[model samples]
Target: MTNMASYTDPTVKHDALLLFEAVDSNPNGDPDNAGKPRTDLETGHGLVSDASLKRKVRDVVQFQVDEGMLSPADRYQIFIRRGVSLNAQLEDAYGALGQATGKGAKADFVAKSAEYMVARYFDVRMFGAVMSTGNASAGKVTGPVTVGIARSQDPVLPIDMGITRTASTQEEKKDNASQMGNKSVVPFGLYVCRVHYQPTRNNQVSEEDLQVLWTSMANMFELTRSAARPDISVRNLFVFSHSTSLGNAPARKLFDSVTIAKVSDLDLPRTSTDYTVTPPAAKSLPDGVTLTTVV
Candidate 1:
């Protein structure tokens, strides 16, 4: 906290960028590191299984029928829907504690303050700067491509294949995507990288805080791609955190269920890991974790 960086300082911003780089790279730099499984984490990468994919597509179709085909009042109504959440404020002594709801709360500063704090805590963007520049290099040595057959009657072609690890050349990226009626181009990509923390007013990161962060992200990956095809494959998904600003998840068994083994299998960050933050204290964490400060 002594040598803290300010938002306006360009030097601090540059360090911020560097922090992102370090976090994305494996904290141990061990390319062979494939994390174990978490009872709390998803079993496999995406919902790229047989049964679930059909169900998801069916749901989408059903939604179109139910709402898209109906009129405004008959199909759906937007006015009845609620807006953002609000918080309640409590003061010392046996005073009044107001119940605030909706975007615009009462004329209470405490209520607004509480609401803002809650929002910042839950916002994903607060964690780090998200990168849009995905892996565009072609001819990555994808270990194997498996596109599922949609209807079973007409088998889909192999949209993805395991290009040998040593087969990578600076040739054009084989955007050569293809598939039969069965094997539709499924959402597939390499795990470029991800971040663990971002610029924020607070710096104190506790073990439990990191546990919650990973757990939430794990849940999100499942929730987001709940409807992927069986053939689809999620090459990589990871989180990057600054070594100095890393949070310690004392109780979390942060191991992924599945990972693309064989080095050069994918043009990803190389590890199945999204990225890792430099834990605040690694020495004390081997056996158990302890917090030095909390902001």
Candidate 2:
């Protein structure tokens, strides 16, 4: 169960590191590049967008709700759900207050509506959103959580393989052979992502919320399996907790404590054992800070 009371406290900061691997899968595809895996042109390393990771977290939340693990009144709704109209969702806020939404609405009404949105939607409270769209403008929130783009530690080679389907949908293809298609994948890759949570942004994130987020990150790959991304897994998760609201040490310094290197000079690594990761020592950690590994 989530501890709802901690959400009101405005003095908690967190930093986390997520290490994951993809085996013969496209972790994230670039629609602009013919659905190929996104990669850095200079470094040749694979890239996974923050949106992709956040979508996985959102899916986990939705799955939990669908399985009756959470209730609608628990204030854990998703605002950016598929096939749902944003205006319709916004209208519900006004409807709850027995009022209409428009340009002429008072400032207090807009503020209250924005607050209501932050309280009702988990994504809004976690990642924030620009609610200025649609008829009902409830303003905006900065949120507290921020996830950076994930990048492979070593260079990766993206391979595009030709695929074919035996069945055809059109009658014109009755005499035709299999339809040709393309599938892109990276032989193997180890990606690392940085995450930050600032309590002062909106003061809406609770201790339980952080716990849920950690769990979501650890299990997102398992829940988001598909042909494009079949063998994605989280290898490590490092969470850095600060005693103060701002932070006790520099994030970059803390991140530098975790180092990753290849075990051998293999042209292409296939397994996680091919790499070695060194996490920070507990005794050497900065004062007023602690580390926790979830995976």
Candidate 3:
């Protein structure tokens, strides 16, 4: 349902990454209020607005798509939460499934798995964008997006149904609970990474700059493999920037904003049932997908 993710980087371990083009920035949700939308934090701090986050997520998701981790038809879900509560839930509930299944009884199995997945999900630890107000010809007049499900300035980066992660000793069955095995905790996920976005310059971006950013970020995302969608069409693609001033701010380079957050402090993450593997089970695509097998 989107443009395929594109990348030419080569040093990533495909199997190690869990989240495909994910993110994990600071401030959890909105600043002022930690995790809670009500509390107000300082200015020019915290993660970019929800809209900014979505754009970045989409673009990064595109990276995975471009890399062939996922297909154009692959479903991608983006969550803009205030914390990693879901991650805790998965760890607390099903974190030990691997141990019981003989995957090894390490005290830190849960933690390690969580860490790997979070890292994959949040491939980019940083995101920056130029700041400028919307101009009649181009640029965005929109400020930071509110951190809730409201009338977004744009579509949710135009994705298919969201993809939820689940782990299992067996394959996942929707109707029969019997097929579901010790899979309680989601093995991997895709979260947030660094997002450098800002108002568009009249639907414009520098090709050289875009290429460089993609080339670098692609390599970084590759580091976390097992979870990357491996398809460019699935990842979100776009440019982002911030405004240095309000009311028709002029977008400029290096005027990007900064946000930081801890994965443990938030209430996000998902758990899914396990699914056995076979060539057929490897991917799910809509009828419209036209994928090129990765060499």
Number of the predicted model whose lDDT against the real structure is largest? 2
Candidate 3 lDDT, tens digit per residue, 1-295? Answer: 1222311111110110011222221212334443322112333211224453344444555555567754322222121234544334333323334423223335465444333332223221112122111111111123211222212111112112234335433455534433322211112222323232332222122232233344444343343233222321113222221112121222222112211122343333321111111111113422222211121
Q: Count the backbone clashes (under 3 Å) in each candidate.
A: 18, 0, 92
**Candidates arranged by lDDT, highest first:** 2, 3, 1
Q: Return the top candidate by TM-score.
A: 2
lDDT of 2 by residue, 23-113 (tens): 9999999999998999999989999999999999998987887788765546788898889998898889999877787776778888899
State candidate 2's TM-score: 0.94
Candidate 1 residues lying further than 4 Å off, grouped into runs, are 1-111, 115-121, 124-184, 202-206, 223-295
Q: What is the lDDT of residue 69 in candidate 1?
A: 45
Q: How far is candidate 2 from the true structure (C-alpha RMSD, Å)?
A: 2.9
lDDT of each: 0.25, 0.85, 0.27
Residue 275 alpha-carbon offset, candidate 3, angstroms: 52
Off by over 4 Å in 3: 1-7, 10-51, 54-69, 72-85, 92-96, 99-107, 115-295
TM-score of every candidate: 0.28, 0.94, 0.21
- Indicate the TM-score of model 1: 0.28
